[model samples]
Target chain A: MRQILSIATTTVGEAIRRRVLLIILLIGVLFLVVAPGLGVLSARSETVVLRGMMLGIIQLTSAVIAIVLTVYMIPNEIERRTIYTILSKPVQRWQFLIGKYLGAVFSLGLMMALMTAVLVFVFWLQASDQSLAAVGAMVKAPTMYFVQMSLLAAVAIFFSTFVAPLVNFFLTGGMYLLGSLFNPFFQTLQENQGTHPVTKAFAGIVNTILPNFANYNVQNPIINPTQVIQNESRYYLEVTFYGLFYIGILLVAGILIFDRREV
Target chain B: MAAAIETKQLTKSYKSRAAGNINVVDNLDLHVEEGEIFGFLGPNGAGKTTTIKMLLGIIYPTSGEGFVLGKEIGDMAVHRLISYLPERPYYYEHMTGLELLKFYGSLFGIYDEAKYRALLEKVNLHRDMTKTISQYSKGMQQRVGLAQSLLNDPKLLFLDEPTGGLDPIAHREIRDLILSFRDEGRTVFISSHELSEVELICDRVAIINKGIIERQGKLTELLHGGRIEITVGGVDEAFLKGLNIPDSNIRGLPVGVLMDMPEEQDPNGIIDAVRNRKGTVISVVPRRKRLEDLFVETVTNPALGGKPSVPPAVAEEIVK
Candidate 1:
């Protein structure tokens, strides 16, 4: 356990030292500043514009955080031969993988929190004359966004364990895109199933394997305020649980693959 | 007593993309007793680093087996007893020297910071402990690398070119440190291209070439006993022409008459030749062979010409 903690701390220290954390912060701040400008010419209501901006920022920040951090961690260590010092010890390979995953997750978690704060602040600024209930709804949307990003981070780690960082980045990014596009594609297939049973079945199989990123997207409720579904917290919580479950499974797979890696 | 390290037909071959398979380490056997500084000598790309990496379990061998502290290597438990210093010292550049040591110690399950601190002081790195490793000089980095290897006070230490970049003083300090480790009953396996340094510190040495153990034994046994120089005065070129010494026996002359003579072989014949002359004998100097010359001779040609298995007993006694 202590060894895992040591590995974790080292991984975190390495991540911070690489200025990855700083870059994430800079991107998040930039997104927050630009999000309000989209409201100016939009035909959508102010609440809707704010919510869209919040959702866009969350998705963009989470995807970047997951892909960038996961891609570099293992490759950098192998290049530096730091992995040798750690592997020479009595520690197991699985421990090293888990420790790295958990450490990177911690870094991503911190970035998500900071981005969430900026999001809330932006929503508050746009809600000057609005009711507290409306502002509260806007603030609540990001909770689901965090769960989605955490899941993406786990998938990125899984790819990193077996492939090079650049390939891993492309793979995880593609998966994130697929996950986001899956819901609408699946719904369309289901609606046309009377004439397209084969296409519907293929969509069903992909839906089962890929994460349902769209389920955690709550931006519409924040933007259209009137669309806020009351007592829908249970659905949000279930999605969060689902995200955690997938992250856990992917993390286990990553550990197994990493253990067999010769390095 | 068990051998500190032993390998039986250990081999490793790397598969190359641009070329055919290259055997980095061929089927080879080796053994080093406990408390001995065993020098693993080989030229660059002679599989020296590969052998060390296999011993540390950093890489798996293509075939054969090895044991460290009587436990089969590439096993997690055996790795715990071994400490390795790579040829090029690389650490967490962002970490301070002390922090790097502490981190390595922690991985080895050494929780006490005090113990690691003492090790740093022992390696003469306590003063540089707080400075980031990136800011340190090459010598200082090497010292910290040495200190890190000693973090757990491992029974078997694998050092790959520990003195490569060190200054003369730093090199001596490291050599003394290695000697001290042996004195404490620990075993050190050192790989180096520096033959003289190896000869100076190693209890026994193994010379590997093309992934095979070319020679292995105590330093003394490998070197030839000595050379004999018989200088005769008052004998002109006419008398010298009458002598029947083989060209192989003559080692050139400012000081004349060089010959490799056995100790037991009677010096009477040569003495007679000089005494019978109308001239005086200047000197007969017996010179013992240096390690470097022996190393060159053995490595160049292990077959020291198909003479007798042993040299004459008298000359051997003089060397002993």
Candidate 2:
């Protein structure tokens, strides 16, 4: 455990210092700060448009950070020969994999937290008339987005063990898109009475295999004042559990593949 | 002394489109006793790194057995007693020299600041402990690498090209450090192309070529049969021949005669004969057979199929 933590801590230190990640994070923060101005042109209520835009910016930026941070995690170690030194120690391959994954997730969380903080300050300044409870409620979406991006980082980490960084980049991005946008469609198609058996079976397989990234997109309820989840805390807990469970599976599979791999 | 590392018929094979399964390290048999610096010498594509990787368990061997510290290869218990410093090693640039040692030390559950500091000091990097790796020179990085490799206090150290691409001072510093490892009773297995460096430090050596172990033995044993050259003035070839030196090559020069004899022969006899014949002795040069000559002979010999052999002089030196 100590070995894993040391590797994890070192990885986080390196990841946070990476110029590309910091630049992506800066661009995200800049967009969130400018989002209120863009919300003025929207046809919807100003608060609703601003909330949606800010959440969109956070989600998009976090996704990019997660992908970019993790896609090269394994490859960079091999390229720089750092993996040779680490593996030559008593450290197991699984420990190294888990440590790298945790580091990526931690770095992603830090970047997401900064964007969230900016989102809160901007929303608070724009809607001072709103209650503190309402502002706190607005922070919940990014909290869930953090869990969502952690899952995304895990997806990238898993693919990175076997594939090149460029290929893993596209592969992880494609999975995120499919899971976030089309997962529900696939789920719905599988349950529809009119759906063909072959299509239903295929949808069922994909829905089962791909993580339900959309489960954590709780912005809909938080964005519109009228919308509400029946049991908010229970819903959050369930989705958080689902994300953790999926992440566990991906890491386990990745460890198995990396154990036999020659670096 | 127990064998620190032993491999029997160890092999690693890869498939290629041009050829079928090719062994990168083929049926290799090697042995290194405890508390000695053993040099693994080979050409660029001689599978030196592959052999190290297999012994370190970083890669699996295709077929065969290898033991480190008397445990089977890939056993984690053996890892606790071993450390590897790869060719042109890289450490985390963001880490200061001290922090880098701490990080590697933590791998073995060691967190002693004093030990880390001492290791840096030993490598002569204690002064630069606060400098991040990026601020370091190439030599400093390598010194820091050595510092980290000692974090676990390993019994066996695998150093691949420990002094590669360094200046003379860095080279000497690293060489001294490696010699210290052996003096401290640690088995050092080095894979390097630096024949002169190896010659200076290694007690024994093995030369590999095209995935095969061509020669393996003590440096003194492998580097045997040097030649003795005697240059003299005013001595006729007939007079030198009359002295009747066996297995000697006597060439006539403008000034006198030159006698090239095996080192085993007494040079005093030839000098005495030259003097008695009224010849003035110019010089007696003992051409010790170098590792480089033996290496070239072994690596390029068509008879051994690119295996190890002594040069013509050493071979003749042996015959005499």
Candidate 3:
């Protein structure tokens, strides 16, 4: 456990200092700060537009950050020969893989936290009604996005063990897109009684294999007061649990492959 | 002394689409006793690093067995007693020297500040502890690598090219530290291309070529068969050659006929013949064989074969 934490700590340190991640984060913050002015151009309510725009920026930024941070996590260690030094110690391969995954998630959380802080401050500064409750509600979507991104990082890490960084980058990004945009469509298709059996079977396979990133897209309820999540606490807990379970499986698979990998 | 490391036909092979089943390290049998600096020498791609990785349990052998500290390879218990510093190792550049040591030390669940400090002092990097790795010179990075390797106070230290690509002063500094490992009763297994550096520090060496052990023995015994060069002025090349010295080369220079002969044969006879023939014995120099010569000879010649070819006396002494 200590070895894992040591490797985790080092990974976090290296990840945070990576200039590419910092640049993406800076851009995310910039967009959040300027989102209110852009809301003026929208036909929807200014608050609604502002809220939706800021949440979109945060989600997109976090997804990109998660993918970029994790795809090279294993490859960079091997390229720099840092993995050899650490592996040559008493540390196990699973520990190193878990440590790197945890570090990526932690660094992602830190960057997302910064963007959330900026989002809160920008929303607060621009709002007509300033309520602590409103700000608190605004932070919840990012919290869930943190879980979604954590799962995304795990997927990237799993592919990183067996694939090159460039391929893993596209693979994890594609997984995220399919899960986020198409999971609901597949879920509905699988449930439709009148649907063709072959199509339903295909949908069932996609739905079963892909993580439901849309489950954590709880922004619509928070952004528009008219919409509400039915049994909000149960929904939040269920999705978070789902994310963790999926992440656990992906990590186990990664550890198994990494244990046998030459690097 | 007991063996610190022992291997039996340890092999690591990789299959390629173009080549089909390439043995990077084939049927490698190696031995290293405790408390000695054993040099693992070979040319590039000779599988020195591959062999070390297998022994360190970083990678598994395709076939055969290896033991370290009397435990099977990959035994975590033995890892607690061993450390490996790879060729051209890279530490986290974002970390300061002290923090780097702390990080590696924490791997063994060791958080001792005093130990980290003392190790830095041992590697002569205590003053640079505050500096991040990016601010360090190549030598400083290597010194810090040494310091981190000692964090566990390991019984066996595997250093791959410990002094590679360093200046003379840094080379000497690392060499001295490695020698100190032996004095402190630690086994140092070094895989290096620096034959001269290995010659200076290693008690025993194994030279590998094309994934096979070509020669293995004590440095002194393997480097035997040095030559004697007798330079005689006022002597014709034909006259020197007519002396019929065995395993000798005679070259005619403008000022002298140089007769290079085996060191075992008495050179005094050649010198006497040259003088009696009215030739001035310009100079007589006995050149002892160096480790570099032996390494080149062993690696360049396939006939030396992959086995211990130690002189009979030295072989017996090593056995006892």
Best by DockQ: 2
How far is A81's C-alpha from truth in model 1 (Å)?
Answer: 0.7
Q: Write the per-residue lDDT of candidate 3 for residues A1-99, one digit (tens) a residue.
A: 888778888888998999999999999999999999999999989999999999999999999999999999999999999998888888889999999
Give the per-residue lDDT of model 1 (tens digit) for B1-320: 57999999999887899877877788879999988899887655668888887887777888999988898887888777888887777888889988998888888778788887898899898887899999998888888988888887889888888888678898899888889999988999999866667878998888776677777888767664665666666565445546654432544356444444544344567668767876656777766666656545544553643222223342233123
Q: Is the docking of candidate 1 incorrect, acceptable, medium or high quality?
A: medium
Question: How would you encode candidate 3's per-residue C-alpha lDDT over B225-302 as one tens digit per residue?
Answer: 999998998779999888898999989877788889998899888888888988799888989998876766666554
Give the TM-score comparing model 2 with the true structure, all chains together: 0.96
Query: lDDT tens digits, residues A116-171, model 2?
Result: 99999999999855688988998899999999999999999899989999999999
Candidate 3 runs further than 4 Å off: B229-284, B305-320
Candidate 2's DockQ: 0.88
After superposition on all CA atoms, what RMSD does each candidate show versus the true structure?
Answer: 6.4, 3.6, 5.5
Q: Tell me the whole-model lDDT of each prediction, alpha carbons only.
A: 0.76, 0.91, 0.91
- TM per candidate comes to 0.84, 0.96, 0.91
What's the residue-level lDDT of A201 in candidate 1? 82
What is candidate 2's local distance difference test score?
0.91
lDDT of 2 by residue, B143-169 (tens): 898888888899999999898889999
Q: Chain B of candidate 1 versus the native chain B: what TM-score? A: 0.79
The better-scoring model by TM-score among 1 and 3 is 3
Please name the candidate that would achieve the greatest TM-score relative to the true structure: 2
Higher lDDT: candidate 1 or 3? 3
